[model samples]
Target: MDQPPVPPAPTEQGEPVALSPPLLHAMLEASHCGLVLLDDMARVIYWNPWVVRTSGVALEEARGRRLGEIFPESAGGRLHQAVEESLITGLPAILSPRLNPHPLPLRAYAPDGRGERLFTLMMIKALPVEGGARRTMIQILDISNSVARERQLREQARELRAQAEAIGRLADHDNLTGLANRRLLSELFFKARSRAKRSGRPLAALYLDLDHFKPINDLFGHRIGDLMLVEMAERMKACLRGSDCVARIGGDEFVVLLESLHHEEDAVIGAQKLREAVGAVCRIEGKTLQVGVSIGVALYPRDGEELEMLLRQADAAMYRVKQSGKNGVALTTREEGGWPPFG
Candidate 1:
């Protein structure tokens, strides 16, 4: 909620680290995500407590060993290949290997006794250093559930196009809330901008920042904080039409992209509805938390023609509203500034 809290799944909390190695080790030792650090040569340099828990390996045994040595049963040398390529090519590599590969005729080497079915999908990325070889960070995710769901989804796709939105609920929606995320928002935003340009209708983007969200996380555990986000997404959805796009843009932020609006009032009315809808306090599992939405509105053609331009204006308006107090909307202007935050 406070500027994106770490990476996916859950994490174990510990004390802060400054110039402390013991404290840092303690932190990693406490994390829920299985963390394994590798060197330039793809050798295990550091293995954490979660890794031990998930992998059933001890540090004394794992350290000074290569990944292939430890997981010899894993015929998927895709991780090694990725590392070699990244080292030589100076590029990043991310691969989610298929969980269930077709078994070949030669089955003597079928370790794990599950044929070609992989229990996990390992996501590895090489982070390059300027004067040194890149360090490859590998995160292994259990996707057995996802694999089963995908198979079921493949069969259901033919009849679900009317609401094909059911394809990848976890992929398309925010993890905490069943709301569309930035990935979907980008798709919808571009479509709306295109249609508005062709039909001469005003397109508006509302970038919303949730006020007092971090405080809620601090007061309540992350479990309840996640529930609150889901509740907020539901409330916003109630205020929006099926055609209008509302998406979570990471952390405590959401954007409402209104399309085919002939007048500014249409978008403004939608914004007002969302504002009123999010006004009430939410109670999650005996904890009462209050959060409000700060909206930044930017109109197409009137604001800017480019999608990036419109988004920038909207984002600027959101930050402006945050600066002014909260629970209100602001606009962008050509005379003020433009957003290409990155060159």
Candidate 2:
């Protein structure tokens, strides 16, 4: 298939109806909306200074970036299709109030990933720009102030959704730890197995049970025990990347999914990190309580392709750590002695 011809690189219009980049930049910048100019193929022809200022994506980088590629919410033939309609019809397409779940916020890589919406009053005008027929100017007003207010009302709705989700999750999540219960584990295990098959990637599962947890519960009370779990969760969260999932399978028992592992050594490194984080003393209510975790790791496509086999192997490996002693990471690898002896 022949690729769509690229738009001539944007330049100061010397003659032909005459619109200078400086003047055009000024006009678009002064306007209250984020402005973008695109070719027939949705190739970015001109992304204005205003858009550069707002989105933190520079005009230089914006050139050649497609309407769908620039933003996160542009997945699955969305906003690109909207642009297609405007160009094809040679009519301005306007959305008075934009509606999209996980709407694209103008600024990228902000501290908050689940960012507030950048509700925009979008106006798409099909026009001749550069040298491409597939061309349009998109104007988006940052209606975030209204969006912020709307977010307040939406907070209640979010809370209601959360409450309902919590009820559903309660069936498969540890209430005290807010971690996945055994039931959820089975589902996750199956999914992980499928991921390994589809992606042809190595997957690692770490089964960790905190050492000396019962002593803390006995020494302090169930109340203090609950606080310790919360503290431990925070510590674990600090150690994990966004891709990893940590679930409390049972009391003081946690499971971690180490994704996209390429080698056997990677699993061992993950186990070490878990040891360091959990070994640290947690200070709660002005009292310092120390605990440790014993972790057993099982690799996918190496240990077993099936979920049941891997989980069973991982669990068995975890118990070995407990039986021998505690505070170490064990990987289920036959390279050493196959199933590692307890401890």
Give lDDT for model 2.
0.75
Superposed model 1: Cα runs more than 4 Å off: 1-169, 336-343
**Which 10-residue window in model 1 sums to the lowest lDDT?**
100-109
> Of the candidates shown, which would achieve the greatest TM-score relative to the real structure?
2
User: Pick by lDDT: which candidate is best?
Assistant: 2
Per-candidate total of colliding backbone pairs:
0, 4
Candidate 2 structure quality by residue, lDDT tens digits, 1-343? 2346444455576433445578666777687567788887778988767677667778788788775677756644445667888878776766665364323446423465444446666777776544545678887777767777888889989999999987998998878877777788778777877777888878888888889999999999989998999888778877877767788877788888887777878888988998898898778898899999988888877776665677677787777888888788887756422544456
Q: What is candidate 1's local distance difference test score? A: 0.71
Per-residue accuracy of model 1 over 43-156 as CA lDDT, tens digit each: 888878756655657888988888778877543466677666765665655556363231111121234533433345555666556477567666655555677788899868
Using all chains and alpha carbons, the TM-scores for the candidates as numbered come to: 0.49, 0.50
Candidate 2 backbone collisions, by pair: 39-134, 40-134, 40-135, 334-338
The segments of candidate 2 whose C-alpha lies over 4 angstroms from its true place after superposition are: 1-163, 333-343
Looking at model 2, which ten-residue stretch has the lowest summed lDDT? 100-109
